[model samples]
Target: MCNAEIDPKTVPHMRELMAGLPTNWGKWGPDDEIGCLNYLTQAEVLRGVASIRSGKTFTLQVQMGNPKGDPVWPGRRGAQRINLMDKGDFICGNGPQTPGCHEFADDLMIMYLQGSTQYDALGHVWYDDHIYNGFDAKSTAGGMQKASVLPIAERGVVGRGILIDMARHRGKDVLDRGETFNHHDLIDAAKAQGIEIEKRDILLVRTGWIGSFYRRDPAEFYTDFVEPGLTFSRELVDWFKEMEIPNLVTDTIANEVTLEPETGVMIPLHCALMRNLGVAFTEIAALDALAADCAQDAQWSFLYTAAPLKVVNGSGAPVNPLVIK
Candidate 1:
């Protein structure tokens, strides 16, 4: 990990930094919203089903309201659940009356769509006044009018997922703060696990970062606040394009190193891969148990399916991805 302090002036603009990368703008169609998700064809669905050796399943979403506080990006509060109706309310004579004497408990949650394990809309981040499929940045005013998560939620994501455990490959419980890895490192880690990342596979990389968040102090966790994840590079972007990787999932707040060490750019991949190339990002997933099981059984591939809450014109949506191995 590079420890150099970042200077805002030295960082290049996103447009200048991502000058020559190829985009997926007209590949699908003029009205395409969900991007590389088109790669999950019927055959790809069958391929995922074939990888299901056992009946065991894992849910990749973290608990929404942890007593110790849920893990979230700085400045965004975690999900807050407040009871609207409960036995206590009935006891206090404040509950709604029912003709048949039926009572129920109800609660409401307030949170950022990206607050938990989530699927980011293709328009979630952009520069140069453009989003995925060249949608105007103005469509995001008030709410997303193009490339919103609703399309993704309606379509759903299902495919063969390959887990690349970076921490285990590097012999660490968790990668250090701001630790970075690229496509080459990903390939090496996949090789070490005796797995091949097939084209169009849902790429799930585990850095053990989220696992450590539970054990460490919240203040310390946010102190230098740098997530260990894939760093932006031209070759890495090319690899993703060539491989047709649909989704990139990780156990980090942001799916890439917070700041590019060399260019001092914040989440360049969000602009390069997501905005330009149209790759879906699933972040802050719970991959500890799944990684451990894969390590034990030596089965790194499985069927991955996720349907984020359908939110109209939303920038992102919460999701609880299901993994069957």
Candidate 2:
């Protein structure tokens, strides 16, 4: 059964824990040092903000998995295409009536994972048995009511977004896959881009990985090529906590520290951001067009908006985020 209730009394210590935190803008607060976890809900979101000055609205979505084509990831099952018409005859008046509308059907595969494109949610990752904002991972997985089950309403996200062009920082158009990015490299790139990180700003990092994936073969995109990603570090978390950023996103496969082949450990960034600080992360965002615009205008911060699909009990959903300068 769904527990459609928010009992602050049950978690009294939570309120006290968050009491010392600054509550600026109330509902429409910007990302802060520790990051804003509760601000994603409808009750705390800002609604009806002023219209965006820019008139452009671009969409960002990845092509779903294909059955006949190569698999998305190794060891994963290939997609399956189904066509209702091919299974049975369209008409059989004397013996059995064929399934209605079978004649007009087509074969297609459904995308099982919603995180294929620009996506975000609380259930996407977990640490210490807790999901986002102290939600128990076991309870949440067992059907307890939580933010993961809720819809990403339109008002939940409305703020200024900044894009850090890592490719530009390297003096190249893009970075290849398997290229590991470190903490100091990000700092240098930010400096080179002349972009100052700010509180409540949505940070978008571009490595040109997405562009490479689209242009090259699937094998080349996944195995032959890789790109630089933010390396997880305790100091980086402290910096974000001090800045009070609410959301952090990137145009990469996973928004965390890429595991070092020598050490063989997963993203430490997830540990610091999601577990320790409760900062939200968005992955696989398409920001090439926006990056170009920012380079031309010499401005990074812009009004941003994203609306995720209303999938119940879903880990994450595909999103088409927009930016208005």
Candidate 3:
């Protein structure tokens, strides 16, 4: 599956990266949404659960239709509308039989599943027609019979969450949309915080872009500064696999540098990590509060769980990741 047209040396990681790209297709078998989640074994989950000493929880999800999110993609019109069930509807009707003693309230949201903070499923990204575990797109469409979000929901994704506070390292509230972070920076940040990259750990990078772009102003976030993100590099993915990290949570739009060094590859890391390797990415996470709490106590990690809606053949869904310490 190597692309021989381009010289291997031309790319950052060389031929080794190319060869590694197409692997893990059937590593866990033909039918598997388990993917890297397999790394988060019972033992790993138990450890994470046990770490919840104080029972303090922080929400990592940005609200639906949050001003911070960009309505750029088609069908991503933020939230169209929200409404509550009228008092005299199906239950009460025009003659309100039980109106005097009626008690009912309901609310609804017309939103894109991936609009706010969300967990992307294996089928969410693809290399041409194939997805993770070598599932062909046509036969394996998501929702029920494919690489759906169901598997992730069933797994009850709980693990140790490690926050690489890039903002704290730089003494800033948020990283500019133009700044880029590399593998070395990830390591340095971890070492500085006295946290070890461990198997099944959920890696969260606080770029601080959430505060600047989404929280402060929407117009400026979309039109202003170049988005600061991950420097395009295969080494980053390699390190993730080495550490057996299954989930990646980031407080940024795309997670990777908007304009990577390689001009053509808009988000090369996405294809490798999600489509090929089956690593789940939780994006647009509002992590400022969590980062501040972690920094305050010099705590770099927490026990966390990200449970997505059980959409049968869903490619992705909004998630409210809970972090407890």
Candidate 4:
């Protein structure tokens, strides 16, 4: 979400100002795929690992299939499907078990590459004809030739994760759909949590919308739920760059409140972070459990690791991110 209530004038003016957007485009080199992941240095990883105390782990991905109804994203396939395989299947499965072996069960999962918790590849977003580093969008016509998920999947991301529970800070069960959190909101929330966000840390914002939607009422969840997410401002963009955060995960799709388009770029956060800043982002994560745990335990930070599927030219993939303390 571009600053809540961006003047219609600002919308039209954004294009001309686009040249000034923050970018790590050439900073990571000409052949950079895993953009900000470079921030996950050896020292940072070791520090994150050292931070672990309780050794309890949390699953950051929501179930692949959710709500038990229509697909979350209309354009893409829905959820996960399991099909009993007869040896060779189009998509590989763990199944086609030994014949007559009831004790052993094997089946293949027809996974929707990105149905639930997932990261956005650096090549995922584009503005008109260009992508990150000013690469022609057509150059990645059939597949992501630049900034594919391959490098991220191979290298993996392990670092400190800081959570900003916006809902609790806001003193509400959840931020209503179309509600937004901006730079000041984040700073204020962090202050309330009594924690400081650090460099190379994975940032996770808990809007509480996901918990409200799934646990309370799916109807209310989908209805008028434009999306309660982050609102991006110039300052927020600069913060991402300044903090050097590698991955930004949120509990909603788009990671920004879905706004009614008045003009150019619809998902401005994606364009700015993915294309210009080369910062990877994950969406639709399950944070309720972790949020509750954080509140009760008063431990908001933890060691984090997210390894996306190593699909050759995958733009992004559904993943099970693990957070341990």
Q: Name the candidate that leads on lDDT.
A: 1
Ranking the candidates on TM-score from highest down gives 1, 4, 3, 2
Worst 10 residues of 1 by lDDT: 1-10
How does each model score on TM-score? 0.96, 0.70, 0.85, 0.86
Give the Cα error of residue 14 in candidate 1, in Å: 0.4
Best by TM-score: 1
Each model's lDDT comes to: 0.94, 0.56, 0.73, 0.77
Question: Compared with the true structure, what per-residue lDDT tens digits does model 4 show for residues 1-325?
Answer: 3353656665654455455767887887887778888999998898789878899999988776554532254355556556455445423654544467443435565655667788777788776677777777876779888777777888898898989999999898788768877867887888888888877788899998666656665566566547877766777789889989888899877788776233433577888777888888888788988888888888888899889888877888878899998
Cα lDDT over the full model 2: 0.56
lDDT of 2 by residue, 278-305 (tens): 5666666777887887788776666667
* 214-317 per-residue lDDT for model 3 (tens digits): 45655656674356777756677777667777888898767777656664345666777777777888888888998888878877777989898887777777
Scanning candidate 4 in windows of ten residues, the lowest lDDT window is: 66-75
Error of 1 at 123 (Å): 0.4
- What candidate 3 gets wrong by more than 4 Å, as runs, is 1-22, 66-75, 84-96, 140-144, 224-226
RMSD of each: 3.0, 9.2, 4.6, 5.1
Q: How far in Å is the alpha carbon of 72 misplaced in model 4?
A: 2.9
